[model samples]
Target: MDDPRSRILPLLRQGERLLWVGQPDPRVRFTGADALLVPFSILWGGFAAFWEFMVVTTAKEPFFMLWGIPFVLVGL
Candidate 1:
């Protein structure tokens, strides 16, 4: 049987179109871009690692099962 969810799911996942505007300076190059991206990547990566550790280490208990599993899964 054909599922009604097929059409509805596509629309639900579709995001609004966005245009990315670049920096105005022509002199800005790879080093400049790297400098900006590296710190953000490091910070986010550390947070993610710490978060995963908390989730996995705590998952053995009922409290972690009920709360941590879904919170980390969906990202509240």
Candidate 2:
């Protein structure tokens, strides 16, 4: 694979220096807030998905189903 930084070098202006070049660590780091947020997020997402599913299956109007689509995608 080509160096990812190669593409960035030409974009630098004259006399400018590239001091740092690196990729972010591909690891999951959790904070104390995650203890509350994680479960809340799961419940919120589950409810959104369930709402969309019910709307799609039970609703006769297209508007109702369409309204919940964005919420479902955002939940994902």
Candidate 3:
């Protein structure tokens, strides 16, 4: 440990001790999970936006009003 009057002091209150800091593994690698989730999220968002635009412009009847509910919920 260094002197107590160090230039940059840690903000610990009384009766505190530093345990651990920083990532256990700093290395980066592609994973199977990200490969699947990324594509799924993109497709979900695209479909939601397309459905919303169609409902707003081309079709605005009573049935279409209810139809857009699913897209809005998914987009949110």
Candidate 4:
């Protein structure tokens, strides 16, 4: 009754056997696509942030400034 597998015992079928209990490695590993994606993301995010800044600071139209908020968030 002290076994770790006891936690899941209720969910098993009448004759089922527990063979393995494990979790995947928690790690971050970048791949080849990241070489291209990293720079592109930086450019897109930078432009979006700049546009939002300009709209918020100098643009007088409320609707135009508000529209850029979503773009800035997505860029992040």
TM-score (all chains, Cα) for each model: 0.38, 0.58, 0.47, 0.58
Model 1 CA deviation exceeding 4 Å by range: 1-30, 60-76
lDDT of 1: 0.59
Task: Note the residue pairs that clash in candidate 1.
Answer: none
Estimate the lDDT of model 4. 0.83
Q: CA lDDT of each candidate?
A: 0.59, 0.83, 0.70, 0.83
Worst 10 residues of 2 by lDDT: 22-31
Number of clashing pairs per prediction, in order: 0, 0, 0, 0
Of 2 and 3, the candidate ahead on TM-score is 2
lDDT of 2 by residue, 1-76 (tens): 7875887899999999788888767685887899998998888789989988888778867998888878777767
Off by over 4 Å in 3: 1-30, 62-66, 72-76
- For candidate 2, the clash count comes to 0
- Between candidates 1 and 3, name the one with more favorable lDDT: 3
Task: State residue 9's C-alpha deviation in candidate 1, in Å.
Answer: 49
Better of 3 and 4 by lDDT: 4
**What RMSD, rounded to one decimal, does every model reach?**
11.9, 4.7, 6.5, 6.3
